[model samples]
Target: MMDENDVKELISSYKNIKDRVEIISNKFDRHNVKLVAVSKTKPTEMIRILYDKGHRHFGENYIQELVSKSEELSELNEIKWHFIGSIQSNKSKILTSVKNLYVVETVENKKILDKLAKSLLNNEENNNNNNNNNNKKLNIMIQVNTSGEESKSGCKPEECLDLVKHCLEDNNCKNSLNFLGLMTIGNPNATPDQPDFKCLVDCKNNISKQLNIPLDSIELSMGMSHDFEPAIEFGSTSVRVGSAIFGERDYSNKK
Candidate 1:
């Protein structure tokens, strides 16, 4: 329902945020920090506008909405959809069925991980049967509840290592799921020196050493529209931003 003026504003806002992220990344000597434009309630036309402008990475927080958008935008071959919301156990099959689903950034337990891996295997087999042989493994990140908030959907900081080990070593998961990194939703009121961010950073470092992988290999997906600048400085490789780029969401109509 965005008019031409709304479209213009969206693009301008997106570009401004993108440029700011790049500037902060450059200032801190961090390169390749991905800006996942969080498009949960936004319309596909707005997404397509950004897509046409060469912004391929988009994130959705709800499974049904994500599936719809992925299908609607299926023609855009290079689109990378990041699912940043909580994963329900029964929804794994429907979620993995989504085409161009680049990563699921809210994996917190072995159950969800196993289900996703199985779904990915089935999807790959289906693709092979159809002579479509691009068998790319889906990327997954462990969500660490660094702030210890009961409302957040992530594993405790201490539990992350074991979960990550299971992800890397389990036969079902290793084959279809790529252990990309750790993700977190920190305390909303915390400042730049938020201990939640530091806790997540520690989780990444511990996982890297315990698993014998390089530090850079484990991406930290922290930060949002509010504190992305500090997040980049705190070694966040991927930031999920929503309202800053798309304007405030009108959640009234959402069920």
Candidate 2:
């Protein structure tokens, strides 16, 4: 039910925040920092409006909603959907099969990663059988619990390096998934020199050094609407921002 007025308003709000994000990123020489507009509880109409306006990267925190939105927006060929939610093991198949899903940014364990990779490999086989040769590998980021928050969903900081190694070296993952980088939902009240953010940076550094991977090749997805600027300042290559652009979510009717 989003009309022209709603569309225009959404675009306006999106541009305002996007501009600020870019300014901060550029100030830190992070010119390639990506803004994944979190569209979790928002409608497909809202997503369509932004897609029509040339916004390609959108994120969702719920798997069902993400799959529904991707299906609805499949006609938009260039749209990129980032799954920023906590993935359930049983739902990996459904998540991997989403059309135009660019990346899953919350991969926490080998079990989930293996499930996702297997599902993606199956998708490849299905596409091959259907004569569709454009089966692209899915991108995945290792989620790190930098703040050691019990409520947060991610692997502990000490365990992140091994996970990254597994994602990079696992045979099935090598063929079916692209190890994109690291993602984290930092502690809310932390300051600019946020410990959570710094821990992610350290994790990336250790991975790069120990795994003999280049630092530049490994990206960091560590910011949300509230702390993206500082996250960017601490070398975040991607930020997931909601609310600031689409306004606060009404979770009463959440999917």
Q: What's the TM-score of each model vs. the native?
A: 0.97, 0.96
Best by lDDT: 1
Candidate 2: pairs in clash: none
Model 2 per-residue lDDT tens digits across residues 35-124: 899999988888888888888999999999988888888899999999998899999999988888899999999998899989988888
* Local lDDT at 123 for model 1: 88
Q: Residue-wise lDDT of candidate 1 within 1-255, one digit each (tens)?
A: 788899899999999999999999999999999999999898899899999999999999989999988889899999999999989989999999898999999999999999999998998899999999989889999999998889889999999999999989999899999999999987889965789999999998899889898998899999999999888999999999999999899886552
Q: Cα RMSDs of all predictions?
A: 1.2, 1.2
The C-alpha lDDT values of all candidates are 0.92, 0.90
